[model samples]
Target: MAQPTLGIMTLYLSEHSGVEERSYFRKVIAQAEKLGLRAVVFTPVDVDAKNKRIHAYVYDTETGRWSRSWTPFPHLIYDRCRYQDSERFRKFRRFRATYTRLVYLNRPISNKWGMHQFLATSARIRPHLPHTRVYSEHADLTAFMRGRRLVYLKPINGTGGRGILRIERQSGGHYLVQGRDRNRRIVAPKLVSAKQLPLQLAAWNVKDRYLIQQGIPSKLPDGRVHDFRLLIQKNGSGEWEVTGCAGRVGPKMSITSNLHGGGQAVPMTELLRRRFASEEKIEEIRKAVYSLGYAVATEVEGRFGRLCELGIDIAIDPDGHPWLLELNPKPAREVFARIGEKETYEKAISRPLEYALWLYKQHYGTSSSRRRSGAGKSAASSTR
Candidate 1:
C-alpha cells in the first residue's frame, strides 16, 4: 500500500510563567486532528540555527502525552514560543533556530532593537499605514512636533495598548498629555510646555525602541475615540478571508481602545449601522472597510512568506476612512470573542495547521495510509 497522505503538525508551546495561552493552542490542534490531519505540540532538543541540530518532540496518543523523537522529521512546525525570562529567552532563541530549518508560519514581527526596521520599511506599505516615525532621538521628535498639535508616542514592540501616550497642544504654549497608569488606566493627565519636551523625553526615556506618531484623530459621532479589529484568516484553499469584525471604543480618557486599557468591543455590523449609517450607505462602508483590510494584508503578505492570517487594527476618521493601525501576524484569540455574535476564531486559528499540513504533503510526501493500515496490526505496532 502507498503511504498515508497526512503528515504530522507540531506546535512549539513557550512556557508562560503564570499566564495561560494554551486553551487556544489546544483548540487549534483538536480542530486540525478533527479535520483528519496529524497534529501535536513540540519542543526541540538541541537548537542551533547557524549550525543545524535537529531534535523534535512527537506526540503519542496511546500514552496521551508528548515525547521527544529524533528521526522522522515533522512536516510542519508553528513557533508560538514566547520569552518572559532570561532562561526562557535562551530557549526561545534555540527553538526559533530549529524551526527556521523548516518553514516558519510567523516569526517575531518586531521588538525594541529592530522595530524601526518595520517602520523604515513602511514606505512600501505607505498607502496602508498611518503617519509614523521612530522617536529615538529628541531632535526627531522636536522637529515632528513643530506645528503639529496632536501626537502620540508608543513602544515599538508594544502590545495591548501598553506605554501609549497622547499629547495635544494647548493654550499658553503648553501641552496636555495623557498617559496610562501601571494597570493601563489613563488616570493622570500631565500638562507640559513646549520647552519642557526635552525634560519629558528624558523622564520617559525608554531604553528600548519607540515611535512618535501623528495622531489619526479618530472619533465617533459623539466624540468618543474608537477603532476596529478586523480578523483575517486563510481558508483550506489557502486564501486570505475576513473572519469577523468588531468595534473597540477607548476608555473615557484613554487614547488606545485596547482591552488592557479598559476598552470595550461591540459587534461591528450592529454598532456601525445603528450609530452612524443610513440604509443606503451601510453596505458601502462595510465593503470599504473590508477592501482596505485586504489591501493591507496583501501588501504585508508579500514580505512575510506563507502568511496564514492577520489581525488588522484599523481606525476610521470622522469622514469614514479606515486607517491601518497595525497588522499582527500572530493575533491574539481573545479579540475575536468581543464580536459577541459570530465567533470566527476557529476559522482563523485553524489556517496555520491547514497550511502546515499542505506544505508537509508537498515537501515530504505522506505516511498516513501506511500508519493507518498498521494501526491495528503488528508491523505498525512495532514501528510505533
Candidate 2:
C-alpha cells in the first residue's frame, strides 16, 4: 500500500526563494511522515505547468534535511499561502485559476469587509459582530463616528495588524489618531481637530481599500489593549472543534494586539481573571467565546466551502459580552506555543494532518484499494 500525499502550498517570501514558515512546514512534513502520509512544500513558481509536475521541497526523516524533488501534485493540497504584494502573488493567482481541477483541503475566504457582510446575513452570528462599514469618503467616516467614541480604520486585506489606525473622539472637539503603518511601525498618537482629521489620514488612501469598524473597549488596568484568539479545527471525524484559545495583550502605545506587532501571548483564563472579579463571570465569557468560535467556523465553511481550521480574533467587553473582531484563514499557531500550552500547541499542529488522513480515506478509499476517485473532482468543482 502507498502512503497518501499532501502538498502544502505556500509562497516564497523573497526572490531568493525564502519561505516564511519554513520551520513550521518542516514540522508539518515530519508529522505527516509519522502518520503514513507524504508531504511536500511548494509555491506556484515551482510548478512545471507543461509537465504537470512540481519542483517541491521534501523532508528526509533520516537525514533531517530538506531536498528538492520533481513530483506529481498530491492527493490533497493545504493552501498555506499568505498575501504577498509582488509578482509571486500574481503567479499564485494564476496557479489557483489554472489548477481548478486539483483537490484542496481549504479555499480562500473573502476579505474583512466582504466576510463581515456575509456573516451579517446570519441572524445568529450577526450580534456577535462589531459594526463595520467600507470606507469611501469623509462622510462615511463621520457617519460611522456619530455615536461611537472610538473607531478603527483597517486595511481591508491587511494582516498582522499592519496599516491599522485608531481614532478616538475627545471631549473638546479634538480627535486623537494612532496606528501602525504598512511596515508595522508604530505611528505615535497625534491630537487633531475635527477639520484636520481627514488631512491626517489622507496618506492612507482609506477611501476604497479600508474599513471603519466600531472599536471595542479592551483596555486593561495597565493601559494595554487585549483580545482573545480562539482556534477551531476539524477533527479526525470531520467535525468542527475548538482546539484552544489564548489571550493577546498589546504593548504600551500600540492599538492592535498582534504578535507580529510586539504583543504578548497569555493564557485566556489568566487574562479573563484580570478583567472579571468573579470566576462565574469568567466562565460564562469563556463558554460564550467558544460557542461563538464554533458558530462562526460553521457559518463560514457553509458559505465558503470546506475549511480545515480558522483562528478567530474575539473581544470581550466590560459587560462580559464577546464580540467578533476578525477571522484569520492562514493563522499562525505560534501563539499557543508562546503561551506554554504544550498540549494545545501540539494538537494545533497535528489536527489538520489528522483531518487530512480522514479526508484521504473518505475520498481515496482504504490503503488496499486507494486510487484516484471522483471525490476530488466533485470537491474541486464545488469550490469553483
Candidate 3:
C-alpha cells in the first residue's frame, strides 16, 4: 500500500527560479512524512501539460536533502503561491484553469476592497470593519477624510506593507503624511498645507489602484504602531481553530506593523497586558478575538470554498475593541517561532498536514483499503 500524497504548489520568485518560503516548505514536507503522507513541492512552470506529470522538488529524509523528480499529480494540492507581478503568476492562473478537477486544500480569497465589500454583507462581521472606500480620485480621499483624523491609503493588491500611506490631519489645517514605498522602505514623515496635500501624493496614482480606509489609532506611547496577527487553521477534524495570536510592533515612524517591513513580534498576552489595565479585561479581549477569528474564517471559507488556514490582521483600539483589518490566505506561521512559542509553532506546521491526511481518508478510505479499491487511480484520473 502507498501513502496518500500532497502537492505543495508554489511559484518561483525570479527568472533564476528563486523560490520564497523554501525553508517553510521543507518543514512542511518533513512533517508530512511523519504523518504517513508523501509530499512534493512544485510550481506551475514545472508542469508538463502534455505529459500529465510535474517536475517536483522532493525531500529525502535519510539524506536530509532536496532533489527533483517527475511524478503524477497528488491526491490533494496545497496552494501556497502568493501574488506575483510576473509571467509566473499568469502561468499559475492558466494551470488552475486547466486542472479544475484537482482537489485543492485552499482557494484564493478576494483583495482588500473586494473582501471588505463581501464581509460587509454579513451583519455579524460588519461591525468589526472600519469605514473603507475605493480611491477613485483625490476627491474620494478628501471626502472619506472629512471627519476622520487618520486614514490609510493602501494598494488593493499590495502585500508586506508596501505602498501604504498614512495620512493624519493636524491642528491648524495642515496634514501629516508618511508611508512605505513599493519596496517597503519608510517614506519620511512630511507636513504639507491642505492645498498642497494632493500634489504630495500625486506620484502614487491612487485613483484606481488604492483603497481609502479609516485608520484605527494604534500608536503606543513610544510612537511605534502595533497590531495583532491571529492565525486560524483547520485541524485534523476539519474544524477551524485558533492556532495562536502574536502582537507586532512596527519600527519607529513606520505606520504599518508588518514583520516584513521591520516589525517586531511579541506574544499576544504580553502585548495585551501592556495596553490593558486589568487581567479580566485582557481575558475578555482574548475571547472576543477568538470569536472574531472563528467567525471571519467561517465566513471566508463559506464564500471562497474550502480553506485550510487564514492569517487575520486585527487591531485592538484603546477601548479594547477588536477590528478586522485584513486577511491573508497564504499566511506565514513564523510569528509563533519568533515569539518563542515552540509548541504553537510546531502545531501550526503539523495541523495542515493532519487535515490533508484526514481529507484523504474521507475520500479514499484507509490506506490498505484504498490500495485494494484502486483509489489512487481514481485520484490521478480525476485530477488530470
Candidate 4:
C-alpha cells in the first residue's frame, strides 16, 4: 500500500547556516508535514555543499524535529524567490520538472508589453490605475515629462524600491528627479526638466525598459506620504480574503514608501481615523482596497493563473481616492517585521502557510486516502 503524495515549492531558503533564517523555513516545512502532508522546498540552487539536491530537510511538527530526507517533489509551490541569480536560474528549470500544480503567488512576470496588455484590458482594474506610459525612446519620455507637472520613471520589471525615479517640477525649467541606479544606489536627485532631461537620461540611464507614470497626488498625513499594503490570501474555501492591511509612511518626501526606503508601518485603521475625518471617505478607501485586491487577484490569475498570493501596493490621493502602485506577485514577508508587532508579523507567515495548505489539498487530494489504505506515509513524505 502507498500513502498519498504532496509536492511543495519554496522560492527561497537560506544560503547561510545561521539559525535566524534557517528556523523560518524549518517551521513552514514542519507545519505542512504535521497537517498530514509531505513538504519539500524547491530552490533555484542547492544550499548545501555536500550534495547538489534542490530540496533540503523535512520538519516533524509533532516532534519538533528535522532530519535529511529524500526531497519530496512538491504538490504545491509557495513563491518567495525575489529575483533569479545566475546559479538559481539554472536550478529553476530543473525544479519545474517534478510538479504540475503551483501556488505561484508570484512567478516572475517581466515582460512589459504583456503586463500593459493585461492591465489595459482588465475592465475591473483599468479605472483604478494612474495614467501609465511605456517607452523605449527618449522622445516619448521627454514629451510626457513636459506635459505632466510630476511623473515617475520606473523600471517596468524592477521591485523593492529599485530603479524607480520620481520627477517633480522645480523653479523655472528645473525639475527634481530622484531615482535608484542599477546597483541600487540612490543617485542624488538631479535638478532637470524637459530641457535637461534628454541629456541627463542619455548619460545616466542603464535600464532597457522604463515607464513614465503620471504621479498621483499622494496625501501626506503628519508630513509623511502614505500608502496601504493589503495582503490578500486564498483560504481553504478557495476564496481570496484580506489577511492583513498596513499603512506605510514614507520618511518625509521620499518618493517611495517602501520599507526599504526608511518608511514606517502603521495599522491601516489607525491611519483612517487619524488622517480622515469623514467616515464616508474612509469607507471609500476600504472599498477601493477590497475591490482592487479582488480585481488584481482575478486579473493576475487570468494571466499567471498558477499564482495564489499577492501583496498589493495601493495609494490614496488627498481626496481619499485610491490608485494602484504595483502588484507584487512575489511580495516578501520581511516588511511586516518593520512594524515591530508580533501578532501582525505572525499572520504574515501563517497566512501564507494556510494558502500553501490549501494548494496542497487541491493538488494531492484528501489525506484520508493514506489512512484508509493502511499506509504509514509515502516515501515522498520522508524524502521531504
CA RMSD per model (angstroms): 8.0, 2.8, 3.9, 6.2
Instruction: Mark the regions of model 3 whose C-alpha exceeds 4 Å error after superposition.
Output: 366-384
Question: What lDDT would each prediction earn against the true structure?
Answer: 0.62, 0.89, 0.89, 0.64
Worst 10 residues of 4 by lDDT: 375-384
lDDT of 1 by residue, 102-206 (tens): 655555554532433454465544554656777777788778888787887877764667777788889898888777643576746789887886787677664
- Give lDDT for model 2: 0.89
- As for lDDT, the candidate ahead, 1 or 4, is 4
| lDDT score of residue 22 within candidate 4 | 49
Model 1 Cα displacement at 279 (Å)? Answer: 4.0
Model 4 C-alpha lDDT per residue in residues 247-357, reported as the tens digit of each score: 887776566777876778887867777768888888878887888888887667656554556788888777777788887776655656666666666666666666655
Q: After superposition, how far is residue 194 of candidate 2 from its true place, in Å?
A: 0.9
**What does candidate 3's lDDT look like per residue over 132-156, in tens digits?**
9998788898899998999999989
- Per-candidate TM-scores read 0.76, 0.95, 0.94, 0.79
Q: lDDT per residue, candidate 2, 106-150, as tens digits?
A: 888999999999999999899988999989899999999998999
Roughly what TM-score does model 2 have, to 2 decimal places? 0.95
lDDT score for residue 55 of model 1:
45
Off by over 4 Å in 2: 366-384
Clashing pairs in 1: 4-367, 4-368, 4-369
Given candidate 1, what's the lDDT at residue 144?
Answer: 84
